[model samples]
Target: MDVTKKKVLNGYHVIFLVQNVMIGMSLLSLNNSLSAVGYSQWWFPILFGIIANITLIPMVWLSLQYKDDDLFDIHEKLLGKWIGKFLNTFLIIYAVVLFSAIIQHYLDLIQISVLPERKITGHLILFILLTVFIVKGGIKSLARFCILTFFLMGWIVYFLRWGIMYGEVSHLLPLFNFSSSEFWEAFRNGYNSMIGYEFLMFFFPYIIHPQKAFKHASIGIWITILFYLSVTIVGAMYFSEWQLENLFFPILKLFQAVDLTFVERIDTFGITIWVFLILTTAGAYLWMAKKGIDSVREKNSNYHIYAVAIFTYIIINLPFTQVMKETLYEKDFYVSYGLILWPTVLCIVHLVRWKKKEVV
Candidate 1:
């Protein structure tokens, strides 16, 4: 019963995946959302983001101890086979639904900004088809794609800061305008934008260098939080709260507002860079969904399942609409039900089972 892995993407690849996965299109709307919660104290979410990762360190360690078993397998070992299967099913659905919603939102932005009259369904199909083709290449190709995005992330951040030198500082005035509860509430809900961290459960087993995963994931979380905090601060300073709350892409809006002597349209440039970041994030989730299937007994399941799931996502989002997308964010905090609570409880039960077996 030796289960061999067909997915060959390694640890170096995981580093890139870590960077790419967190830099989602939502990075643009963070400030606007924070503002909606009536808080200019933007550091609160950044602090919570750091703390959340620290809290998950035990889960990370327990995951590594299993010789690279993904969360699904770990669940199966502790919970019964049926219960594990049910959880995995929910995870698959969760990823597909959540990412589909994301794709639709981005497509909504492009349609409104780039082509006001273009149909989203066709564009969504074409875009998701592109995503599927890439995933079909399997883990190695996906990992390499992620590596490319890491460089993109670094350069884009540098360009954004350097390119927009003329941004207004007054926009950031009266930073302490909101109450403590309002700030913390916004921070707690905003954690969903940092949603990709949960994928480590599926990806840890595939990591070519398992030993570095905890360290790398830790560093990755810190870097992502810093980037997010910086982006929020920049957006906060560049755009008024009302403008941000209504704008689909606040980061791009900030760029659009800037007028340096040499550059007339930093916003267009920002959108272009965003395409790469968004594609990488979407692709990483598709890959993780595929990898989650690797946890099953059938060794080759991930390779095929990933492709199928991508096509399925295409169907779900192809006819997607722009209405009430914020409703998804409503459930953002609710993800704790699955991502944190369920996994944490299962991990403890797993340890108890392991200890009892050792005694026997």
Candidate 2:
């Protein structure tokens, strides 16, 4: 591999990459999703941040062990080629399904919240084409795009102050009143917002500073946590318990509170600008799927990228009922939980094998 083409990501790119990936469409629904815990739900994002940090350790450790390989290659190294190929195929499918789900959910939101007349297939086609363009330039290009997305979409946070001003401080009271079941339910419901950080496992080899990767990645995760925490807190304060439970995209409702005289219906603009965040997310997954294909073939080619992108494009465009689509997307949450545990299991396997070899 050419040096120019490989090992190009620095610390901040890694940081922003993780941050942008973690903060996606899920941020909009997160407050509503966690409303099960009511006023105390503000702290759930902090819990997610802690979990994100912990799950990240095994992934980072495993990647540092094979500095040149992504998780797909690491899977083959840790398992025999045949078993690894099987698992890798499954992982590729997971990536494509995940990509489809994210795109579908985002497009659905756009259709419902912003652009009602446009065909979903039209939006998906344009989105996937743009994503393929980014993915084709390879991971470095994708990382740079993520950086751009962070700067572009991040200012939306400033709008939260409007929600805060209209919010009642009393809604934030009785913060610890939730039971364990409510907390667990809220945690599970909100965990999907934290899903994208695991993409780090697949892109770790590109990081120039693997030794400090954890620190930088943690910073990114914390940045996401800060945004999530702020939004959740503001949302808790802003919406009544019943309103929080009912609003599908609480962030959009938050945007509605903004008193911008020049731009009426700011959420319409928010959804339009939010395309970058969705692109960053869907592009990352598409790249990972492409990488998995390349790993299986033992070579790199743009054909794999196009194939996966097309597959994803088709998957989302399929005429599944809304109920079916929701079910499929819901399944991804469990699949993601499995992906998080996967690294820790692999690390344990590696450690055991090393120990036996040392003893021998």
Candidate 3:
């Protein structure tokens, strides 16, 4: 498919696309991720938002330089075909690993919290089928799904009010109490929640108003930041420092603060609805991996989507030990950090190439 000819997503699509992707699985465990900084973790989301916005500059700048090409195609254009394709292989691998890791994490959560009695095979098959169906519709379809999920899941944040009303205001005090090294560790660990925006590099070509993409994406990032801030602040207020550090999924506990007579287990409901966010996140990555394959093969085919899905299933099902699997999905975030910083490298290359052409 000619992605250049399919630039159908508008500013609104860009806004929700960035927001929904960044608000996925990580949010459930985010308080624990930032526990290195203690209760002051409430403000870390703003810092992350700033960092994300700053990094977005080079990504948007590089994307604007090649309005008709994605990061994969731009790689081939700026670097030589051989070197670009070599890098593209790694990009494809990153996308596939991320896609599988996301699904694996979500499935494990569901089995533990939502369906403890059921085996995960059925859930995995169903989730993959839904993800494939969504991705088959392409980026525009994915954008629409994102918009839908944003509205559907966004209201869940309001439920945090219950936690806020009951929480101790004192817990939010003692700001900046963490050591610099501890703050750095919190930044690194919590950054996983911010991973989804870098995906804009792959889908930049599909955005209808590429010129305004930076503005739209920044808006999306701030919106997510506000949502995260509310949760983190509420978590700080509601949970003791020890609880914040020990709880595997603090958001679930936050949901338990809602004492509605009509609903018995709001955390279960919250987690079940959370599948929508997971689908959008995983679907976007799956689409990105498919595009990477398209770039590698020099053709777009539905089979590439299925191929990626199959590969993801095989990877998730591999007989690795639990520790190894956890390391692959949870501990190994260097690749994501590298991708976020990669745009600066490309921008430097672009400037050098421009200078050489002008001199010639």
Candidate 4:
């Protein structure tokens, strides 16, 4: 495998990366998740998402403080060398676990929802082959793949339109308030689904053109939220707060309800978009993990290290039981919670440690 050096992503490419990272299982789970609180509060995640990203900005900006040095440099400098190394080690484990969980989730999703009778192992092989294909393409090719997924963007828009056409406004009236406890639980539960901001830790260094970094990143978040808000609205609109109560993947089912004269099976189209979304999510995390490994080397060298890092990730995706797959998600969520909080705190700690009176 020839590991070619790639340029940083452009402005539009950043939007692609951001949307892809946040869309995957979260979109699939949004209905079930919002349903956890009742559809009356599906918009809570929408609001919570905006708030969470507001808090996340400082952490992302902190990474830029060391824009020239990558995350490990930022970590070591603020916390001292040993602590930075320890954090780097933790990041590697975090990325691998996150990657594996997505693999497990995507495979389980395709097998259960669309290809019920197909052999489970077939999904696993597709996972590995696609992972290899995207990684081999490197970041540049990953951007192009994101561009290709734009073709499916039309389908997403159409799905939303069709669902809305059949949706009744009366289904959404009578805003009922849950107890304080339920509201908080719903908000937090929705927050759990809004992952992927901390990825800037690894990817910020690769945005290529630093001058436009913040501009591109902001556009990415806004677009992601817009796309997902439509998803939330579709779920809450088509299904009554009561109807969507316990259904998992209502977003998928919403599309399932669409019946075109010639395009009888909309499930196929849904699965296709899901697969495209999966690649972007997987590719982003893999790029982060791969970038971290490359940072340990001197710029660009043999592809062996990158190959082994990703190959190990591929092996980790193999699981025989559904329970095991869900457990991976549970574990990744807990671990990611730390990633979200730590980076923010690390930035403050760095600022105090440096004792800079003003921004350097």
Ranked candidates, highest lDDT first: 3, 2, 4, 1
Write the residue-wise lDDT of candidate 4 on 1-360 in tens digits: 224334467877776776567666787777667665565654565585577567667666786677766676677777777777777767766676677677767776777877887876666666756876786766767767876775666356676777788887564545565677777766666666667756656656667776666666666666767776777777777887666666777777787788778887686667756777777777777666666555544365436335744565555545556577567667767777777777778777876867875656
State the lDDT of candidate 1 residue by residue for 55-148, as single tens digits.
5576677777776577778767778798887877677656665666567667777776777887767767676767776676765666677777
In order, what is each prediction's RMSD in angstroms? 3.7, 1.5, 1.1, 3.2
lDDT of 4: 0.67
List clash counts for every candidate, in order: 0, 0, 0, 1
When summed lDDT is taken over every stretch of 10 residues in candidate 4, the lowest stretch is: 296-305
Ranking by TM-score: 3, 2, 4, 1
User: What TM-score does each of the candidates earn?
Assistant: 0.84, 0.97, 0.98, 0.87
Residue 29 local lDDT, model 4 = 72
- By TM-score, who's the top model here? 3
Taking all chains together, the TM-score of candidate 1 against the true structure is 0.84
After superposition, the stretches of candidate 4 with alpha carbons farther than 4 Å from their true spots are 1-7, 174-176, 296-321, 356-360
CA lDDT, candidate 3, residue 166: 92
Tens digits of per-residue lDDT for model 3, 167-229: 999988888999999999999889988999998988898888999999999999999999889
Q: After superposition, how far is residue 320 of candidate 4 from its true place, in Å?
A: 6.9
